[model samples]
Target: MSRRSVSTRGVKWPIVSAVGLHGGMDVLELRAEADAILAELVGAPGGSARLREDQWQAVAALVEERRRALVVQRTGWGKSAVYFVATALLRRRGSGPTVIVSPLLALMRNQVEAAARAGIRAHTINSANPEEWESIHEEVERGETDVLLVSPERLNAVDFREQVLPKLAATTGLLVVDEAHCISDWGHDFRPDYRRLRAMLAELPAGVPVLATTATANARVTADVAEQLGTGGGEALVLRGPLDRESLRLGVVRLPDAAHRLGWLAEHLDDLQGSGIVYALTVAAAEEATAFLRQRGFRVASYTGRTENADRLQAEADLQQNRVKALIATSALGMGFDKPDLGFVVHLGSPSSPIAYYQQVGRAGRGVEHADVLLLPGKEDEAIWRYFADTAFPPEARVRETLSALAGAGRPLSVPALEAVVDLRRTRLETMLKVLDVDGAVKRVKGGWISTGEQWVYDSERYAWVARQRAAEQQAMRDYVSTTQCRMEFLRRQLDDEGAVPCGRCDNCAGPWVDSDVSAETLTGAVKELDRPGVEIEPRRMWPTGMPALGIDLKGRISAKEQCSTGRALGRLSDIGWGNRLRPLLAENAPDGPVPDDVLQAAVAVLADWARSPGGWAPDVPDASARPVGVVAVPSVTRPQLVGSLAEGIAAVGRLPFLGTLTYGGPGGAHAARRSNSAQRLRGLFGAFTVSEELAGALARSPGPVLLVDDYTDSGWTLAVAARLLRQAGAQQVLPLVLAAAG
Candidate 1:
């Protein structure tokens, strides 16, 4: 192989070129042409800008030799530039428009703008812009579009896959996979949808160039992706660079608890260099942090999966323009967010994988001289990691169950319809279906998914290996937190960077640069904010789709007469304050006992606040109903003691009579129905609860309102079903209260 070297910031890096010239263009001529294009793409003064040697090598491999390549570099190393430059060069040679499979809407937006600066006309087709899809497709068909960007999910869409993908694959000048590490199941953020790219790759016309790029693939992930990229081509030329970011100053800030961690952020957020991101492990934590920060007079916004699309776009714009001090976010904002001068990144809890942490922190310090990256590791991080781990590829038996259900349906079954038969959660079931779709076990069409009747063997070995890999990565993250070695070097080494060395910038290399001390007042405020517990448990107003498929007549919205009032919970299990306290107690192995005194007190306080708050049962409210005349417990087979105690305590506190518990009239027992989808959960509880004669008499005596108590509420189906029974029996109004809520 012939190699070229470019000097950047006084360091020489080698670029490998494994192919000869094409289209009467020699290596030297191609290099000159690529340099000219780079200058135009970057809008350099008088076309003075030039391509780095490695970038030129990758470009040359694609344009001059029509070869596939993978580029693994740091966040700001110009991976997008490679594809844009190649697209320009390939188009000039009379090739077809480039097709780029991008991951995030933010990334696609940035790419479109960047391509314009280079004089390349770009268009995108994602879920966000459905109305423009027809026009965009026409533009591509007319050969007026320079590049067309589509999300991975778009590749498998029935219309796109059948109508658009074939034409695009046949005519595309270049194929680019941005954030390519997602294709590897071994990668920290593997997405099953990316696996569909293999079919597209295989369908490409011979000699079409391809480029895959990412910033956070270790050796294992790199190898996996490279192998996939070579599906049609002989081999992919991989150009991996050093992972060090000279502008990043990494450190760990150890705090006593969630309160201290949040308090430190409140006290020192402005002291950080500039506007940046504050990452939380869960959506609830992010929302909580955002609320507390705003209450403290800081301009911050929350961005999570639950955030509306318009709000997400607005939040991204706010951060880009420095309107907000920080965007408290979950992993939803992790990849493809482009901010050149993001001054700092503060993680409320360590991610399960060091590679994922590196990818997130890489968002900062990309274009600045120095940026701070701090990790405030929480003790609850491991528990969260385990919770997420449980959602991985379902057990072999579950997979078979899904396949059998599809096979027996005799026609297409929508995900919601499948949910009634399959016990998996909606998201998990959809993910499994996508994976099965790729494996040819199922096919998605106009109505929904249908069985292909393909013999699908469960790859238990691969799944087990992946699970082990996840465990190892989690352990590596724990080590990274406690390691005495250089923090940056540790991260680099985890990514298999052979050049990893002490950067002398991290807290481990030098002394900590961030202040850990939080003011007493700030700490008190944080504690108070966290201690105030009460999350509205929105009642399930509508039945789940495809309920009739399960032999149940329920459909559409549940009638208001049978519906429970919007209820309340002491706190969410994902909450930073109460979650830490409640997780262990509600854990599968935790001993079931009466609610603790502290929890009981918290529940009482929650009730007090609920009474006086707006739309509450306070007498001052115009249409306020009388307070609960009695309390009734929802029978809990797993924690009967806890439910009984909570109901009795609340009734005693309110000086209301304690109604007897609802009898368990089971088709399927209460505990047996746990963790299933809404339809399945409702089916299990349809007639599972019955108002006993004693409870019915108590409700008849009062007939005003009743407090329905349960140990926990996740799907809200239990409360909904139980409330319906009570309403049908006698109670005028039912208000549900629970110890903890699950997101």
Candidate 2:
């Protein structure tokens, strides 16, 4: 296990001396050795591959000087090469495995494979591979693993942090923070878990050679990350290069609407050269685009947060191997996907941050001569941006409530248990907890979270500043879409790239290369697809965890008899189809009125389609009792007219009785039911809807299936609780029908 014994491809690395020189080798000789290793790492033909000057400087700083460094280079700038070459050199001197904190699973997988190409043994311990943790840890302990990749969230796992992190920190040769922008609150993709690295950086035995690398950080983000990297008391070496992708030809395609944008894609996707990615702003949009493109005889698939991991892997492989034309993806497929020949990138809607947009489009044209990058900005882009921005750091009051609850618990409280006491949804709650954990306000223990009892002051000023920064970024994106200047230069300037200049390749600089004209046939088909309605609303089968703690006495599987049957919604609020039409009507500030005639017609069509579907209530089907004999409306605190009118209209169309609306008997009126977490929402909704005596009598008289109508279904708890009440009141079955599903 001596340092000299670690050989790759019959090349003997120089031994390290106590003075940190490679066996008395001078700088030039060491540089020669690094070049030789880089040749093997990149498979450079004839061993002629060499690192860029900056890449070489980074390697030398880490290996020879043992200094922390921050590298901000563009996507295809051989940043990975700097680390793998540094790992090879560092291990030659008998340093423990290099620990990499990568952000995404796609990035980790790509890094592992890339490491193998350079004769470095790399392993990952992510949520996706829990069963291999023990073996991976053993490999690291035995020095059989050269590189260990882990997600940033893994840094704070109670067991991993307490048991594994200390050992890794002590023996680590080099620490790499990939996608380093995430560590900065100023960055577009700020992640709280990344802040835990500050503690590890402080604990690192001096001169452990820390490196933080990113392709997306602007000047502000760079300064923040560099400052964090220097937490151990030595200034980090900052190496930033031009943030331009020479292989990219940028353009903006301004279409009239979602249908035209989709139509344009269908018309021109085949001509975009090799396989690529079609980026959508939401899961629904990605799925919608994927379905339309496939129906148009194009090979496509959807990749989003909701896609199964197995399917994501398959989709990645398909796109990599050109098995499919493209993967209709959200930001899930954004970073570190190692398709060097990706031919194009198309955004169905512009992202709110130009920096994020740059990071995504950088995935293309890595190894190729040129790749097309088009921004098809949508009118609804700003609305989608606002929806995502709603999950920013919670208010001071909410944070204090969470801390108070944890303090009063006297024991560790799991997130689900905390949901009963706190109002934040699961994801936002977890995010807040991570931030609090970093701030010394709370601690995650074996079971769940516990109050650290540390006097924590809410940083309201910092949070407000971050919020304003987000707003400014959104406006910048608006400017990007409308700017007549070079699109690439605009992005580069946003990143504060000093080397940014007009590329003379974008649509504004040169005449548009992409044909914006959508064929009449394609336009008609896309419009028809978007116009189609009725998405299945899968009913919740199990109550929220720890519901009994809310005094509802509900837990485990909801009884089959009490559960509402599968329901239907005209569309999802995040979808590209009916969502556009329904969003305005369902907006909080929208005027309360009867359902519009067009929307009513769409709802009626949804019901008809539901009745005719297999396992539906069509008379041609075998089951006579399946058909709803009457319609019951969930009393809408905000939109009673909309809900009642829709119910009456559906009942009239179907020749069924219109049962009266359920009574809103719960506390706090509509505000209480608007809680974010499922547990709290259920608690608010448990007694909210009561079947009135008139509705009870109507249900009892019908004694068959009933259509439970509502204006919207967000948590589905409103529908579930209302259905439970209706079922208890003598309705034989409850079927939920709604205008829109919340994304």
For candidate 2, what is the lDDT? Answer: 0.87
Question: Candidates' lDDT values, in order?
Answer: 0.87, 0.87
Candidate 2, residues 70-102: lDDT per residue as tens digits?
999999877888999999999999888999999
For candidate 1, the 10 contiguous residues with the lowest summed lDDT are 6-15
lDDT value, residue 73 of candidate 1 = 94
TM-scores, all models, native as reference: 0.94, 0.95
Residue pairs with clashing backbones, model 1: none
Off by over 4 Å in 2: 1-25, 617-625, 667-672
> Residue by residue across 1-743, what tens digits does model 1's lDDT show?
56676533232345554345333446667677776776666666354456666677788789878999999999888788788888988898899999999888888887788789778999999989999999999999999999999998898899999999999999999999989999999898888889999998999999999999999999999999999999987899899999999989999999999999989999989999889999999998998899899999999999998999899999999999999999999988868898888999999999999999999999887767889999999989998887767668999888998899888988888988888888899989989999999999999999999899989999989988998999999999999999999999999999999999999999988898777899999999999988888988888899999888778899999987788887888888877888888898888878889889999999899989888877675333234467888999998777888889999999898888998899997854576766889988988888778888988888899878789999788899999999999999988888889988987
